[model samples]
Target: MRYTFLLYSDRADSAQMTPEDWAREKEVYGAYIGALQEAGVFIDTDWLHPAETATTITRKHGEMRVQDGPFAETKETLGGFFAIDVPDLDAALAWAEKCPAAKTGRVEIRASAMGDD
Candidate 1:
């Protein structure tokens, strides 16, 4: 099965990260990604820009509407994601537990609906 791990964290926390903290964070995530790659389960991964950069589009009453920033106002914003192929939910959960965000933020695991993974 293929699962995507959506990482969410408080934007304020990221904003407070010092240069050293950012470097350490990179190293931590690097190790996590390396582990996934070594296990041959890594599919894809990416970090998103701040939520303020997002552009939202919606259609209602046959009219199109555009909005700036994220659709929801929340303390935690989606920061990144990792797509991996694992055997089952248990395997996916294990991987998600190892993610750095799982410690400080949230990791939402969603199985792929395509069923080809």
Candidate 2:
């Protein structure tokens, strides 16, 4: 099965980290992804730019509306995601726990929707 790992973190708190810390964190995450790829389970992954760069589109009073930023303001913002194929939920959780974001933030593990693309 394939699982989606949603990484969420506080952008403000992350921005406060030292330059060295940031660089090291990036390196560590890169290595983790590389390991997943080597294992042949990595489907796709990407990091979002930032909440400030996001645009929200939704229905307002039965009319389509467009707005700036995410739908809701919260302490944690979704920063990235990893889609990996694994044996079961246990394996997916294992990988999610390995995510660096799981340390300071959160990693939401959810099975991919069942349907034809």
Q: Each candidate's lDDT (Cα)?
A: 0.96, 0.91
Q: Would you estimate the TM-scores of all the predictions?
A: 0.94, 0.90
| Tens digits of lDDT, candidate 1, 25-106 | 9999999999999999999999999998999998876899999999999999999999999999999999999999999999
- Model 1 compared with the native: what TM-score? 0.94
Clashing pairs in 2: none
- Any idea what lDDT model 2 has? 0.91
For model 2, the stretches where C-alpha displacement exceeds 4 angstroms are none
> Model 2 has how many clashing residue pairs?
0
Query: Where is the poorest 10-residue window by lDDT in model 2?
Result: 108-117
The clash tally of candidate 1 reads 0
Candidate 2 lDDT score at position 47: 90
Which prediction has the highest TM-score against the true structure? 1
Error of 2 at 56 (Å): 0.2
